[model samples]
Target: MGDKTDPNTTKIIHPVYIVANIQNKVRILDGKKVTYSSWVKLFKLHACGYKVLSHIDGTTPPAKTDEDYESWSEIDAIVLQWIYGTLSDDLLTRVLEPDSIAYEAWTRIQNIFLNNKGSRAADLEHEFNNLTLRAMPSLEDYC
Candidate 1:
């Protein structure tokens, strides 16, 4: 028999798929003009595609040598690109600087969104309190 490979049985290249389908699909956020509602929607969009975004999280295991620097640099560039690419120019100026780390940038955006208080928060709380399951549905739909 001639040597042949089955394309159907070949392993899928996940990184390519992640880059194309998940990473590229992330919408750029207008951080400067974002309202609470828009911020929440953008946050959910990012959360839904976090697997692609996780490359930017830089969670490699701790090491004692200088060998990891190259890898770390690559991760840092990816994370920084995502951070800068997603923010509006006005907000980008506020959140990032030459010395800022990726984690800090990510955390800053999250804190800005999460620290909401006042009328909007109260209104959302009221709606959440009144929410009920009306009919049979899948768990995702119920949620």
Candidate 2:
């Protein structure tokens, strides 16, 4: 075969695909913006397509001594990297925990955005103002 290969057939290449697809398709999830839901959905679909959804969805991992645990841990780390890479530095610092796994980090992020409706509302209002300002000639026309 040529240099081309199917990502699923090779574990080594799967991560490359995951990172590229995620970084390219998903925008950086800055807490200041109102893109969290769309970002989550896009990342989840890619993770599921690459068969690593368990890394972020609270799936139980095997014991440290288990043979499968080694591979599982490696994949989990990769998934964590994907999440962190797409996050803004401030938010990453807020959610980063000592020795935390992908699932824990994911849950913390979900809670931060989901429970904080005030922040979301503020962002939506900012977005609405910005959109109208750019789209219309003046405030009266926008209203």
C-alpha lDDT score of every prediction, in listed order: 0.58, 0.81
Predict model 2's lDDT versus the native.
0.81
Q: Which stretches of candidate 1 lie above 4 Å from their native place?
A: 1-23, 31-66, 119-143
Candidate 1 overall lDDT versus native = 0.58
Which one wins on TM-score? 2
Q: By summed lDDT, which 10 consecutive residues of candidate 1 come out lowest? A: 14-23
Cα lDDT for residue 45, candidate 1: 61
Per-residue lDDT over 105-127 for candidate 1, one digit per residue giving the tens place of the 0 to 100 score: 77677666667557657988998
lDDT of 2 at 2: 79
Which candidate comes out best when scored by lDDT? 2
lDDT, candidate 2, 8-114, per-residue tens: 78445555344554677667898557378888988888788788888888788999989989788888887888888889998899888888888988998899888
Angstrom error of the Cα, residue 142, model 1: value is 27
In candidate 2, list every pair of residues with a backbone clash: none
